[model samples]
Target: MDTSDILKKVRRIEIKTRGLTNHVFAGEYHSAFKGRGMSFSEVREYQFGDDVRAIDWNVTARFNHPFIKVFEEERELTVMLLVDVSESSSFGTQKQRKRDLITELCAVLAFSAINNNDKVGVVFFSDGLEKYIPPKKGKSHILFIIRELLSYKPKKKGTNITETLRFFNNAAKKRSIVFVLSDFLSDSYQDALNIAAKRHDVVGMHVYDPRDKELPAVGLIQVKDAETGLQQWIDTNDKQVRDYYNQQFSQHAQYCRNAFLKSGAELISIRTDEDYVKALQTFFLNRT
Candidate 1:
């Protein structure tokens, strides 16, 4: 895309997602994700009902009076967005393409992290790792992320979620919150997901279009596999063919649900045409 067009798109997303982050998600985001641990703030005179274990023995002995250590949650966190730039995300027959919806979702999450004073980073992947933006805090970094989300193109078109998760595990040493946004059309990623979830807080966002679940009776149609670039003709008018297609879609959906469940991760499903804001709000509220 041209520089002017990219800037325009970034500005548009910033205006929409920033407002939602400020108004709808600020509190929910804060409550859903926790800090590293409690850090000592100061020591003060012991108050009634204060925990006895919090007493500062040194300060108490020095002052010849009881004092308690005050501590607060260390609220800084690193949020990683493992985004799938596979070609499958380009398909959508709704208000926007699946890729566009994913971009907006990433923007909202990036803004929310920044609003909470947390570090935000992104790992863009397809069949392989495409780009890695190290975790950092600041509005400028977030804007750069949004800009990349809107304009970056992937070199490969296939999906390999395992590669993305493995890259994350090797690159990030500290515990972080990872949101894997993809259609999840690949297989053999269970082990990678299991390992990553044990190390980080992992959430899966499954993006799909309604047409993926069922096909319309539009007679024979030519279909193309977005990832593989294979084309074939299908008889959508035949009841048996339609039924088989629906069944396959359902099986894929079930696999995704079970994969997340087995890994002890959360899954949020969003349709391309639906209001993703409401879906995200519900997810955050449930976590909180």
Candidate 2:
């Protein structure tokens, strides 16, 4: 697309997603993630309902009274959007492609963070790291990220979740709220995800298409692998063939679930045609 077209697309997404944040997600986002990073503010006399675990023994002994440490939520937070820009994102049988949905999702999240006075960044990746936008707060930064999401093309086509996770963990030293947007087609990232989860608050947003889950019985058809550029013919009418295809998707899904569970992270799935706003709202509510 041309520059003007890209700008228009960016503006459209901004209007839509920003509105969602303002009306629906603003409060939810804050309530869900705000109180995570707390800092010691002061020591005060313990209240009747105070938790004994928070007692400040040093202060209590000096004052000859029960005292508790008070902590305030750190206002500044950094949210990272780890997006998958692999070849498969281009394929969607619905009204929108996975890339398109991913762009909108990122836009909504960015606006929500900035609205809550949090800094947001983005990482675009394929088999290798594509680009990194450092964490910054403001509408301008979010607009710039939206522009890149709609226009930036990846140099590679395959996906390596491990590579991206490792790079992100090493680069971002501070603990962050990370949302990884992908279809979960890769199979070798469980170890890397575990490491990331231990350090950061990780959530895997699995964006997929209906076709990814099931094969339509269209008699016979030829399919091409978007990443490898390989073509193969398949008899979709054959029940066994369709079942096998579905089994593969199921296996990938099961692995994705197990990986996130083991890492103590969160995972949510979205289809290209699904209402992503609702899905995100549900997730934020669960977090709260």
lDDT against the true structure, per candidate, is 0.93, 0.93
Tens digit of per-residue lDDT, candidate 1, span 1-288 = 899999999999999999999998979999999999999999999999999999999999999999999999899999999999999998999798889999999999999998999999999999999999999999999999988988898999999999899999999999999999998988789999999999999999999998888899999899999899899999999999999989988888899999999999999999999999999999999987
Off by over 4 Å in 1: none
User: What lDDT score goes with residue 282 in model 2?
Assistant: 94
lDDT of 1: 0.93
**Separate clash counts for every candidate:** 0, 0
Off by over 4 Å in 2: 39-71
Candidate 1 clashing pairs, residues 3+ apart or interchain? none
Worst 10 residues of 1 by lDDT: 248-257
Per-residue lDDT, model 2, residue 103, is 93
For every model shown, what is its TM-score relative to the native structure? Answer: 0.96, 0.89
